[model samples]
Target: MTFTPHILESALLLLATFLIGCAIGFVLRRFLAKPSKLVSTKAEAPVGAKPQKKVAAASPTKAAPAKKGARPAARKQTPPQSDSAESQAIDAGTEEDDLKKISGIGPKLENELKASGILTYAQIAGWSARTIDEMDAKLNARGRIKRDDWVRQAKALNKAKASA
Candidate 1:
């Protein structure tokens, strides 16, 4: 084939365009990618690593000064009676029930429940209508608790445990 300057120029331009595009992609991948922090509160420690005890801070630190146009840092609202009181009840030597035994609760849901301080069938059994709504919202259950009748199951389970 005869070497035509027009075809050669077109091929050269295409190659140059491809190389520029690849260089831009490499730069973007290197500089724009960010490492995300884990959203889960309970992260598993590495194997053979000793668990660190959490030391309570003597006093709360003051909030940092906010910049103009910057939104305030979101504060985690403490759950009312459900979390605090239930955790206290567990701390008082109440044996934690196998929450997974209840219908519709799996290992993941049980972990979420435990994270929210739900430790006993008694706690699930004693949920009021308002508390159920609160828990549904907290767990993002969207009425699963009510639909699954976890309270009824918990009551029966607790009673069975008592009898045995």
Candidate 2:
């Protein structure tokens, strides 16, 4: 209550504390920045004799802390039916058809089918009993394939294409 005489001293002390805090924060930030990758010069060796190993980029000594309220990296997406249909037609490299021709297969359903590696009628027509279950699960169709007889329609379409 009687610091009027020492007002200047109190102000100086406060200023020093703030300056020290700022300096410490700056140093910490500098130390935390990612280090630049090091590249070795290749001119010392013969031009075309043999290539030399690159200086391995150093890993961070400390893992970067996750930011507050930030989400983790998204999970990697797998190709549809990769496990079951690897031999089916994920990369059949054949001409795709308008799956929308099927009664229940709308544009959205067609896209879902395409995303699940069902491009041609032949692929759908060839679905095995096990494959039907897997595809049904993937599409969340609630057994719509069985209900709508998509296999029969696909077989018909496949036959028509073969005839043409």
Candidate 3:
């Protein structure tokens, strides 16, 4: 089939219009999307190290203007006493375990767990159902601990560590 100039021009115009529409849609979505409030400002502490407490600065009566498209500053809150108690129970000068040994735990997950003060296999082995649920929400694991049978694995690993 022979191509006509009119057909070629129409196809080019349609493609140009589609490209421009896509660009506009992308820009609109980028600027109009709501910012997430779960931004974490705390730096990750090394495994087995105690997490530092953050001191809150007094807020001014007037708020400063935020830059367009910049994320809002993360608000700092005092950590629950239960978290510190849990950490203290497991810590006790014990060396940190490699949590990645547990099924479904990777480097990222291990780091997150360490940041939350879960540093030893004993801790994972000791979690009850309620503790697991609290961890699920805290780590955003969505029942991954139960799904992966992390408790059983942790028990075995802890036993092996103890034996060795």
Candidate 4:
């Protein structure tokens, strides 16, 4: 077959039509699409809510006292408690509840608590607000104690243990 002006004109018209069709399809797809709920919705704090900070758990070991003329390394502070409830020392080597039984506490958190000398529900039940805040901070739970109401759960668990 020989190339001719008529065939060339027909081929060019067909290519132009195809390109125009693609452009229209693209525009329609973009303009007519509805937003997907899953893709569009994002987790955002409500306006006017206070922002919260999360810290990672600190090492359980205590450091030696700093020598004079040396700056001490910044350490995670153990919360000071004026209340007598937590003034009693946490008992070690005693039979203890599986702290993982509490919601939001995993085996890692349970081990962390045990390492910190918190082996029993009785000890948790005796925590003052300061102690709770300290423990929450130490665990890096990011307000989980307050959110999960662990103190209430601990008190109930302690009472239950007493009876059983």
Candidate 1 stretches with Cα past 4 Å from truth are: 1-88
- lDDT for each residue of candidate 4 in 32-151, tens digit (9 for 90 to 100): 988666765765442223458898787768757668899867998898644433244565557778888777889999998876667788777777787777778677899998888887
Candidate order by TM-score, highest to lowest?
3, 1, 2, 4
Q: Which 10 consecutive residues of model 1 have the lowest summed lDDT?
A: 80-89
> Candidate 3 lDDT, tens digit per residue, 23-61?
999999899989768979896443334667899896887
Clashing pairs in 2: none
Top candidate, metric TM-score = 3
Per-residue C-alpha lDDT of model 1 across residues 1-164, encoded as one tens digit per residue = 66798899999999999999999999998999896776988855422234588997765477566799998779999775433223334565677899999998999889988877789998888887877777777678888999999999999999999999
Tell me how far the alpha carbon of residue 14 in candidate 1 is from the true structure, in angstroms, after superposition: 12
Instruction: State the displacement of the C-alpha of residue 129, model 3, in Å, after optimal TM-score superposition.
Output: 1.3
Best to worst by lDDT, what's the order? 3, 1, 2, 4
- The lDDT leader among the candidates is 3
Tens digits of per-residue lDDT, candidate 2, 13-51, equal: 999999999999999989997888889865343111245
Off by over 4 Å in 3: 1-8, 15-92
- TM-scores, all candidates, are 0.49, 0.47, 0.55, 0.46
lDDT of each: 0.80, 0.78, 0.81, 0.76
lDDT of 1 at 71: 88
